[model samples]
Target: MSHSKSFSLQKIINYIGGTLIFFGVTYFVYSNWLSLNDFFKIFSTLGVALAAYIVGALLYLNKEYDEVGSVFLMIAGLILPVGIFIAFKLTELITGINNLSVVSFSISLVAFLLIFFYFGRIILLLFTIIFASLLFFAVMELITTKLNYFFDDLIAYQLVVLGSSYILLGYYFDLIKKYNLTGSLYFFGVLFILSGSYFLSGILSFDSTLWKMIVGVIILLSFILSVPLQSKSFLYFGAIFLVLFLVDLSRRLTPFFGEAGWPLILISLGFLFILMGSLIFHMQKKIKK
Candidate 1:
């Protein structure tokens, strides 16, 4: 077979093999789950991970099949989180501390980050960052619940901070010579920030003026960042959200002007676009001159 065909065939084989392994292990575990003790149950899960990691380590250390070994190691890393989660549950059951599982998960996140960094995989690092952030939110909610800090809008504010952190980390990665990942990080960052902003805007919708201003600012900032980053993800998202924001603003103002206000805003926006375009054109021409 040709090289491309060979790769495709190998991929197919790998997928099929993986599916079989998954089903076989799942069936065996479920069928035997009733008879297994707690210790056995916990260790079995962790043992698979440990075994995978050890074999993968051996393969890579020998350098005979480095890429395949790396794949196995990656698989082990994926399963490590599951084992950690299970360990967390066991700890919770034993300690009887309602939210102490967060500590277990925190440890897992730290260990995974260290292990992935040692392995030197940017994609894995990205996955870990995204996963750890989700767990971070989970921990936040748990702590808040224990502390009785329930507020309807608290989650949005936290999300805004989290989104800002992602943006900062994206820039940090860019500084370290990982340019390709900045787009992914920034895209997710924008998504989270915009989401939080939307929620906050909804909560503040009683003030119609503020709603329009908030959404307009989001659109402007998202598009502005896109210009410097040259990221299509931000450009497209900003455009889509701008339309949604305008529609929402129109809907919120329907009590004041019925449907007429929508048309007026649309027309004004059109003229504003024209004016901005002309100014930009003139500026570019002047700069070139």
Candidate 2:
């Protein structure tokens, strides 16, 4: 197929896959609304493995358009299912095998090894860092017996680290027209931001009042930096952060205003949305001109 035709087909496939996945998750959640914990326990690992396989298959099918990393992802897709199944069986047979941690560590390690083989030293190094971070968390959880706190904190730290890596990677990819890099950057950046928000919320457990203000300030600064970047990707990031900031601020202020605070929150959200939309439009027009 011609490049354009191939691109169009890939786009269609992606759209279909995304739609199906969304509906699948929604259906699953709705069906098990009363037993959400059980639902997650049964499906979360399997769901992730299945999704990875689908993604890898898609990449492999578009091998002509994909790079070495795509091939690696395909390999990962294949290995994930097998790895999970093996981990499950091993845990069942063994005296003290934690299936969840083992499966996660195995996948991360395999991914690190695969990327190392394909992309050389730099990518290998990056994957190694990711793998090690995950491994450290898994080991800590296994040893400490009450390492949930450490695990939670590590999760937040990983988000910041990984998210920063994505931004940097995306910057370089955008500069060089590397589509894979662009996609990776966007995916990881969003992951980082959302995870960071959750992490901040967790930190607020100690002192809600103080941490709320600090998080709000940090998020505001992030939005300011993102908005001025003149990049669609960055603008989107900024908009998300702005929305999160507004939500956080509203939640914090609601107690002070009692019932009246609800309307204030709605108005705040509406205004923020309008401001972000206008900013994005203005930026796009400037880019066109």
Candidate 3:
């Protein structure tokens, strides 16, 4: 077979094998869901996770079957959260404290963190951090609402905190030479922070100039970050958001300019952007040469 054909066939076989194994496991456990107690369900799944991790670790350490070992360990990581979720819910049920999802997700985050500690897998760490922060904030909101301590801007502020923390954490990882941690963290980091900041601006009812300044600052920061991270997503999002801010600013200020200067400002901003792009291109060319 051709190389491309062989590669494709290998992928197909892997997918089929994975699906069959998963389906078999699911089929066995699912029918017993109603029949089994929480303890039984939790322990059985954890037993499988433990077995997979031990065998996978031994194989990985031997270095002869690294790929198989990695696959098995990843499988164990994937299975762990299900077991944790059940255990957390069981705890809450016994204690009569509600917010089961939040508690379960929090425990699941810890499970992923433990796996990351053992394996040092970047994706695992990133997802764990992301979900942990989100679940923490969500639980806080839930509790505050239950206790009648909720405020109108509380969750928005929490979102902002979450976003800023992600970005800072990404930078911290980068400084420590953890390169694998950057891409996903930065991508979602920008998403959450920017959206949160935008919402905050609306809630705060900032002046048009202040809004422009905020967007401009982030756009510049993203551009600066893109150079080091080599991430086009950051640049693209920055450019997109800058344009959106400009358009929104123009729309809001149109009445003050009696509609004539509104279009004029748009045209002016367009020319300014084009000029900036040309300058950046020339500067890059000069640096490269």
The TM-score leader among the candidates is 1
- Counting clashing residue pairs in each candidate, in order, gives 0, 0, 0
lDDT ranking from best candidate downward: 1, 3, 2
**Where does model 3 exceed 4 Å of error?**
1-59, 87-98, 152-155, 203-213, 228-231, 259-262, 276-289
Of candidate 1, the 10-residue stretch with the lowest lDDT total is 280-289
TM-score of candidate 1 on Cα atoms, chains taken together: 0.74
**Residue 121 alpha-carbon offset, candidate 2, angstroms:** 14
User: Please, what are the lDDT tens digits per residue for candidate 2 over residues 45-112?
Assistant: 44555555456445545555454334344334434444455445544643344446655666666765
Highest lDDT model number: 1
Off by over 4 Å in 2: 1-3, 6-76, 84-95, 98-154, 172-179, 202-207, 227-233, 254-273, 284-289
What are the per-model C-alpha RMSD values against the true structure?
5.4, 8.6, 5.0
What's the lDDT for all of these models? 0.66, 0.57, 0.66
TM-score of each: 0.74, 0.54, 0.69
TM-score of 2: 0.54
Error of 2 at 262 (Å): 5.3
